[model samples]
Target: MQEPSDVLVLAERHGDVLTLTLNRPDQFNALSEAMLDALQAQFDGCRDDTGLRVVVLAARGRAFCAGHDLKQMRTHEGDADYYRDLFARCGRLMQSIVGCPVPVIARVHGTATAAGCQLVASCDLAVAADTARFAVSGINVGLFCSTPAVALTRNVSLKNAFEMLVTGQFISAAQAVERGLVNHAVPDDQLDQAVSGLVDAIVAKSPLAVRIGKAMVYRQLGMPLPQAYEYAAGVMAENMLTDDVSEGIDAFMQKRPAQFRGK
Candidate 1:
């Protein structure tokens, strides 16, 4: 029940990368109201960080996140207004991750269930430990994970997403990767290394190109096939006008390392 500023989420900066760790290990890093607020604030801060190349959403405890703080929810019991606000706030947080200019990568070590799974799905990329597990298990408690389903369905096939929602069954990290919930699943000890690899690759790219590409990819996902192509073509043309793209092309032609200013 700590305040949002009391380290419900910890923001650590290393060069151009920001690592935001869920700090509620004792509660399995549950997304309490404070935690959600803290996470949103951190992502908001990233919005204007032009030098930032990547963001890693990680957790400190045995579980990555155990969805919402059920104890906190139970305390409010039949407060429909509170529930609506809570879910809306959470939805905004998830959207912020998607709308991030730089890629948001989830470094998942343990279980990520319910809304926690939604968090992973919302990230641009995710790398999980081989021992990690995932589920949208709200149904087990007689509450369907309706909000989580929005993200889950986007990341995986509808059938698989529906099965997870209805069955409330846990899937292994390997299964998660197979279903496209995560990019890679490595041994537990290699989790950090795996995440570092992704971070390094992204940091080496032109920041502007990465930003444009991330935004374009998400924006086009909901478009019709023809409209998506039309939109992407326009975005690509716009990207071609950037100084970074010019540098990239010239470097390729000259067979030299590209020095992108991210312009």
Candidate 2:
């Protein structure tokens, strides 16, 4: 595991599981420029590391993330370029999470509002504490959560998602799961254990298959049903050629656990 630094992002690895914690607890892990860079750089740096099977996006603080740094944004209030570039950077970071080959799980606690909720939505799967809350709340400040909406709308139903966007209302973690924002909501004390259970399940399979499946699912999301099926079929064919698939099938036949080196 890597030692925690004074920097905005903290990275730690436990075997095949990598955990990235948003370290700015005082600011509620607001998405400052430094935070965005830290997240993007980590994802970009780890893009080729196939040995990693699961990435857990966790955070420290009373709130998971309070969204963009409004106080910081005020410093450049009239600078259109700064605002545009800032949001664009944030968008790229979110996309990186979606595009990553390994599955990313958001371990959420407390409030995840505005861009923060988008962060949760950006992950492949999320395990949130029962007390955690979520919202696309930029509307309350008269600046609608447009950037966050891209991910929000994709995860949640139109009516429910729109209500939260327009009203700036927060939803409980259970409600978030009901609306497709999170996979499960467990007790606060069980947060770490719950997330680890998910990680364990993910790492137990062929890492390559999980990676391929992650990429295929996200890529096919925007395609029409016929096109999606065609794409998946091609992917299935390609996946079938991997050594892990053969080993996995043989192991099942032998009635024993498969040995996978992510080959």
Candidate 3:
């Protein structure tokens, strides 16, 4: 059962971009059941909306997120079924972010540990504050961050992800970029600005092209090299048949900006 809170997550829309901010600052915006449900609901809404071009996952307060609410987890004690259901729900939310048509950019401005770090990894892209730190530190409490490891390994090298999980050590934002965990790390004050830069660039492109490309990128990653190429080639061929692609090529030749209607 979720604890009652009017705004576990705050949603703000500016034109075509939707920003979802975690609001439980006092608790380091920990992913309580309520918070997860709030986030899941928001992503579900985005799935069907063609007008939405981008989603920025941000947080309020000092820490972006500290991970799961240990207090809530503690309440369940040794209930194995409860834990399984919880993790399953969390997994579905992460998958939803990946499957979203519009890109989800993690705007990390503070500490993101354990599942918090997993949230960042699940996004299509991320920009972090230079001072922000990340870790999969559930090992410190004698528990392995198995779920986070799944996302971590996909984003970063196996050795690096294993080290974080085993050692429970923190990595600075710049190091995160080096490890391919985040795209850019800017000064703390410029975090939101960097996120907006990505948002602006994405929203300017053809919505249909972006949607198709995002889905193709993830799907191809799971295929064998030759099969991946074949899949991509088919996707590109179909993409070329769209009016947006035709307009893009015409605009390039005509020396004019493309007026992509997302057709």
* Candidate 1 lDDT by residue in tens digits, 13-101: 99999999999889999999999998999999989998899999999979999999999999999999999999999999999999889
Structure candidate 2, residue pairs in collision: none
Which stretch of 10 consecutive residues in model 2 shows the poorest summed lDDT? 1-10
Return the TM-score for each candidate structure: 0.97, 0.97, 0.97
Query: Order of candidates by lDDT, top first?
Result: 1, 3, 2
lDDT of 2 by residue, 119-194 (tens): 9999999999999999899999899999999999999998999999999998999899999999999999999999
At residue 36, give the lDDT of candidate 1: 93
In model 1, what lDDT does residue 45 have? Answer: 90
Model 2: how far is 96 from its true place, Å?
0.6
Deviation in Å, model 1, residue 16 alpha carbon: 0.7
What's the CA error at residue 123 for candidate 1, in Å?
0.5
Q: What is the lDDT of residue 181 in candidate 3?
A: 99
